[model samples]
Target: MVDTVNDDTELFTIGELARRTGLSVRTIRFWSDSGLVAPADRSTGGYRLYDTGAVARLELVRTLRELGLDLAMVRRVLARQATVRDVAAAHLRALDAEIRMLQVRRAVLRWVVRSGSTTEELRLMNKLARMSAEERQRVIDAFVSEVFEGVDPHAPGAHLAEAMSALPTELPADPGPEQVEAWVELAELVGDEGFRQRTREMAVAGARGGEQQPQGPDPERIAEHAGGAVRDGVAPESAAGGEILGRLIGPELSAEERVELADRLATFTDRRVERYWHLLGVLHGRPPMPPRVPAFEWLIAALRAHARDASAS
Candidate 1:
């Protein structure tokens, strides 16, 4: 049982009600005087008196005050100018936006420290914070449309075009500086002649060679030999390489097949194709895989070595 100085039915003094509600006496007085909350009746001496219901009302008032509502809004709430749920929902959205901005500020500070950034960089970071969700999408959309505009969705090359154009349709209201940098770098990378050529070259090459684009280092042999070479750090052309090669390509398989795989791997092993994938991973919020170029390059040489052995035989 809640110990009340006065029972719910009994008229309690304003001071007693204030103590029960944990509101300061002056605040309770102000609310009563403002016509926001009124005592239930007059006491024996005409002092303000409150009934049990006043305790519940006072609790609601305190809640509104704690939530940063001005008295006017509080009164509006009490009077149903707007429903509490409606006002609360709106405020909740506003708070979410504020929290995102603060997170972005922290990221920008860290980026400034990491890059030894100049004032110009600070300005850029600040500017990035001001971008709305729609604005950010526009930036991504424009870049992607330009890069992949002509690609026919029905064509074999359409997949590459689609990958290049994929962007986050929604960014957090306040995106961090790293997100901003990624956007800028991505825009620059897509525009870069080297990167564009690299993507186009790989796409065109994939079309030219289809699945066999990297032949001698065929899928089965690569996952076996090159994959193992990457794991064991073995040079493809070493004298001991024959053992690894034998395991990968099969001792029964002719050296000519290995050479064919190697030549194909070399054609598509350019770093740009890897970077295109890397950027795509970032857009998709994925962790990255290790580079396999060294392993493939090794496989290419091993393939060539197998050719030499076949020639000598």
Candidate 2:
């Protein structure tokens, strides 16, 4: 097309317009034909010429298309329903959530490999990974029964069951790695011989005619002294053994009572039983106890040995 000013004509052709906009004539012609870009004027020879505004509109359309906007989305952007910034922000959030899920799956698979588990173990992993809240509660319920069996349901054993059975009864949709790890550890612990035997001993003890075991007796004193001696690395046959036993059983306790205390502590101060409570506390998120029963068992052994020696003398 020709623009005339002061009787001077300046002519621009279709190819000239394409060169000015840094676009191809074929592409410009296609856009123009599609009604997306239009010609400003038609020359005497019938060539199409576009004004500068057409170039700017074409640039916007190309930018939107390059940004993953389909023709429909590009139309929406052109019509101003949503901004590219808003759409990009929403997509960023969706991508971040996807990345987090993939990370969790990666950790889970890594655990499986590290565990070197059997096919059955692998199946269990998948089942536990997908367990619903109700299903998780059922696991806790079964553990509770196994641990609390033969104990007075109304006794302290029942309280222990309620306290230690602290699984959420349902895992959340997106449990953190710690929660998942906790469940795995708890499952293994409940099936352990140490934990089961500990609970069973406590239950048997409870059924033996008392709500709570008596405290402050000579047996308690002996257990404390004997227990401390073992924990502090004092040998049962050491000279200090007599001192610890004397402090525990006292000067008033007869030789007969001292021997009786030895037998009683041997029966009750079981290390495995103590460990059961420790594992239960971990499951229930309770405060921990310092392990003392191994030391006590050592003391009981020492006391009984002394009793035997005294009888021989």
Candidate 3:
């Protein structure tokens, strides 16, 4: 049976403290031995006896331990080496980091489970989730640098390099599955040689003034007329296509001008480049712009067709 001390001056056995605090006898003994709560005196029989103050100390230690504080920190708290408030503030920062890690792991697992991800993809997702903000930015920077390496910085669309590298420094603390998927795809895309080369071609052409529009056709008119034609299912070689062309480019273009316009549109029109911007937009939380490449492509086809007809006639 545990013995109890009724007054602050009276003493209680470790067993009594354990029963009152709901801690195990072994736990109380360990804390007592660790110098956290020393006995007030020893009985003639050599049994350890603790005063009532020991009860409050033991309870505080138990609370601290249950809150994930380590023994060293608990020792510091007991020794008055650190204030409880100071230790608590430090522990809160540690907890925040742990929470962020758990959130990243949860997002990775959720994506893996939903996609039936392969072993390679699983590895990739985990790796990306663990990357620091600087490392993630480096991945995009390397891709942009590779694509725009030799292109003149003064070139018309050279600023596109900056825009292309605009991934946020860090993913949200609790990212959605789509955000994770977008990051994974973005990682894959930057490493594709074909995609790199396509962007390089567009950049190089723009550097040489190939992307600049001459006095031939107004772009807004082409977007309206040609874009509407494409939406209404007008074939580039059909009479309806010809009508749209007239409204866009006018009827007086010589064969040479038509060829030149086709080349200019081709220089700037790459589907992959458009896709890169679209993916970046998604990552940046922007509303998706309606596709303009299809419209430009239709206009290019119409220009080439009219050029052919003029030459043959």
Ranking by lDDT: 3, 1, 2
Q: Candidate 3's residue-wise lDDT over 263-306, tens digit each? A: 87887788777887887777677899877888889988888877
Candidate 3: worst-modelled 10 consecutive residues by lDDT: 1-10
What would the per-residue lDDT of candidate 1 be over residues 1-313, giving only the tens digit for each residue? 2233345476667788877988889999999998778877775566787778888888998898787778888899999988899878877887876777677677677777778778886786667544555776666566555545555556554576666666675444455555656655565566577666555555665554346455343555666667777788787777767667766665545566666767666767866667656765664667887676766677677778766765565
For lDDT, the strongest prediction is 3
Number of the candidate with higher lDDT, 1 or 2: 1
- Give me candidate 3's TM-score against the actual structure: 0.69
User: Model 3: residues >4 Å from true position, as ranges?
Assistant: 1-94, 97-101, 104-115, 150-155, 207-220
The candidate scoring highest on TM-score is 3
Q: By lDDT, is 1 or 3 better? A: 3
Candidate-wise lDDT, in order: 0.68, 0.63, 0.81
Tens digits of lDDT, candidate 2, 1-313: 3442224434456687677777788877876785666677776667776666776777877776565666666666656787878866766775665664555455457767666678887676656655555676787678778867767777643566676566665443354444455566666667787766766666666545553443324645545776677668888767787666656544555556556766655556666556545654544556787777766666666666567545554
Supply candidate 1's per-residue lDDT for 36.
Answer: 78
Evaluated at residue 310, the lDDT of candidate 3 is 68
